[model samples]
Target: MMWPLSICVLSFTFLMILALSLVSMGFYFVMNDLVYFIEWEVLSLNSGNIVMTFLFDWMSLIFMGFVLFISSLVIFYSDEYMAGDLNINRFIILVLMFVLSMMFLIISPNLISILLGWDGLGLVSYLLVIYYQNVKSFNAGMLTALSNRIGDVALLMAIAWMLNFGSWNYIFYLDCASHSFEMTMIGALVVLAAMTKSAQIPFSSWLPAAMAAPTPVSALVHSSTLVTAGVYLLIRFNALLVGSYHGSILLLFAGLTMFMAGLGANFEFDLKKIIALSTLSQLGLMMSILAMGFPKLAFFHLLTHALFKALLFMCAGAIIHNMKDSQDIRFMGGLVKHMPLTSLCFNLSNLALCGAPFLAGFYSKDLILEIVSLSYMNYFSFMLYFVSTGLTVCYSLRLVYYAMSGEFNTFSLHPLNDEGWIMLRGMLPLAFMAVMGGCMLSWVLFPTPDMICLPLYLKTLALSVSILGGWLGYELSQGRLSFNLWVLRNQFLTSFFGSMWFLPFLSTYGVSFGPLNLGGSVMKSFDHGWSELVGAQGLYNFFMLNSKITQSWQNSELKTYLISFILWIIIIMCLVVF
Candidate 1:
């Protein structure tokens, strides 16, 4: 039954991909007639004007291909992982629903349709997260659902604002782009929506928590579904978001997210949680590069990140499966001896993740760094770029060290070899792609040889950082030196660029010096006066006093009702007299 169902799902996915590819090709040849491919409805106010439209441009096609390809891999991998699970049927359904929602989102014709798909993805993702129905998984799902609702509200508000301005369609909105201020505000709100969805900054805590989901679900969500939605949203609105103050804000946020996430990954002990943080960091890098006005680089990085990250996560799942579902790296060591194929796949994916030269991650990530370096044309942004790259190397090595390089810790329960032919077969292609995907970029996206020049220095720096970080990690694992503790303690330094717990309160109310400070005196007086007026408890006492007064009035219910009726009658009489 499982085998047949798996075959059916793959067939459906392939057919869908083929159909979309043909449609995309048709749009390319009949570019002038692209509107015909979209489902358009005439606006009531304008007989000939359509209210909704979808353009099958180069960008959408590329993203569509990514969605289809990654979804295919996820479904294929799930076949073996979910083989004996009784709820496998529901799992397959949710997978299909999730993929369908993403397809709709990518080709959405208007804000309404985009939001429809957005909400659908969120709904399915929450279900997938809590599939095990365990307490921790439920908690993670609830948090994700709540955060996603915040984003949904922001999106709906933006859509409402746009509708009030009488332009809900992208074409009309773009045509009237001269209202840069209004567009900028909408863009900012949309960025908020994207930030929450992508797990950026304050909203980022939800993602690592989300690792409570099944590994395959985590792979899909992290790689191509929920987290990447933000970058895709920003890319879709590139015209409005680019060249504005909001763009700069996004760039800074993205850079900060990348740095902090990388640092967090280094500090984490759970293997899945570390990869989850890495996903957040890589998504941040993609968004930052997109903010630099290089959509192609962003898209390219998105593609590469999906391939390697999913492969790594699935391999981790295989490891967990073999080790009786143990997720702690402390118990995992020298499994490379037993699961050599899985280890090799995992290592190759990590190499790509570390952006080693000629690998998939190297091409895409180096391109982003190169673009930022050239376009910033300033020493500060350049330095920021360099530091971010170095941190990326650090965390990628941390992931490798904690998982694959430790001494084989003997256990009462011995780990097994690879799961089966199905799991190994599913992982093989991802490993191959991780190794060779970079070479395909030139032929697929950029045919210009000049655009393909390697960033020799950046690659060298990344390789050096990876080697040093890995060596240091290994030594620390073996307790060669006591210095790694200091580095671990200083993890907060990497995240300091974005911490605001103290600053917001301090800025909102004037900062105070000593007891003699004017600001301190003013605050003290204000506190005293408030305490005297409302009593020691302040607002709670005031609310209690009000409640007592109301209770006293309500104690005489008959009298109170008579008085209320009289007032109402008098009000009605006064209206009649007027």
Candidate 2:
């Protein structure tokens, strides 16, 4: 009998093998500078070839490899996390489909083919988000799907616009026609798609709402698949935005998104949402760097962020599982005493998230911050960058303080040991990668070290902000800081900051409120009111009333018939005499 656990094991092994093979191929491609384009002509139309194209370069190959690697581990982790689930097999299948969609997205240079993968991602993610079969999950899934639908539509428009160029293969036009008017439209459309899919600014409400998914799915999503799709798309189409105003717009939104997520994370108590916000923050960083015309740095950070974010989610999953499905951090305290190994991994990933010295995040984040300083930028953008970085550290330490430092806040005899070896096995690999992945990627991606010359104060600024943020985080979490008291007093201000500036309500309610009210009014006035009075029912009533009157005349007494006969005879006689 093939149990679901066995199926998961088999899938994990197969994916691991493929991941290694692809990663090695990617390295070889990078070392030898090779790119292979495989195209199949699926159809032929007037003046166009509907060809399915696959691009295999170092970027695509390595991204595909990392995605598969993380997905395999997540699936393996789910075997333990979802052990008692009756539909674990279905869950595994959904995950595999998601991976396939991501692969299609990564390899396609053609707009049509990219749409296939893009829609696939949006569809599968909706399925996964609604997997729990609850109202909250359903709403979250709808928001996720509809939000990505905007991007899907934008991509379709892009594909249609590319028709003017006589080719759907964007790679061909990206270099030669980058500055043309058509390219500008395409670039703007593409950026809109990326922004929605990546959850920048107004579109950010869906990322946290999607925590209605199971924890393992959250790990996969935040790590490598759904959210990163947009960033990867931008990385591929970066040439289109070069020297364009679109990049500047993207930079502003991404910076605000980064700052918003970090600030909201400090106020978040749900474990998964805090991590989700962190993912959003990192995505903003990636987009901001990419907008500044550093796609390679963005890619570098993307890879490194994937490693630790997955591990962080897995640790949260384990903690939530052991806590009997509780995710509120207030209920978690002194967990380090009970689950030491899990605590170690959690804190390590947290510090990595903070860009602590020599960790996986340090290499990419430090480079990015220094480069931002070195770049020609205004004061506002600069402050946004550094302040967002500090807020990241602040929230991270606050989470640490609340969840791991205080006295036990829950039941006395709860089982909290790190006994789930399978979950631990899944996390251990990511832990190792989270420690060393940055340095390795730094060497591989940048063979020649970037010459970053900065003044001493600027060099030390990142460290200073990080230190101050951590201190503030710890102090505020303890509820002893003056800032905390001020925050408590200002309910409205606190609510605004805590709610992502009420983005979820605006996205969900504000957007829907008007349309919903209009719908209700239409229903009341038309369907049930005027429509009922003048439509089929009204016609039927009119005919019925006339029919009843005619029936009464037909059934009139004999005297009425006699009177009618006498009047007719009198009129005929008078006409004859005349």
Q: Report the C-alpha lDDT of model 2 over 457-546, residue by residue, as the tens digit.
A: 999999999999999898888887687779879999899989999999998898779887889999999999999999988999999999
Which ranges in model 1 have alpha carbons more than 4 Å from their true place?
A: 5-37, 42-52, 175-179, 377-381, 410-413, 451-475, 484-578
In order, what lDDT does every prediction score?
Answer: 0.74, 0.93
How many residue pairs clash in all the candidates, one count each?
Answer: 0, 0
Q: RMSD of model 2, in Å? A: 4.9
**What range of 10 consecutive residues in model 1 has the weakest lDDT sum?**
499-508
- Reference-based lDDT, residue 393, model 1: 68
- Candidate 1 residue 270 C-alpha distance from true site, Å: 0.6
TM-score of 1: 0.79
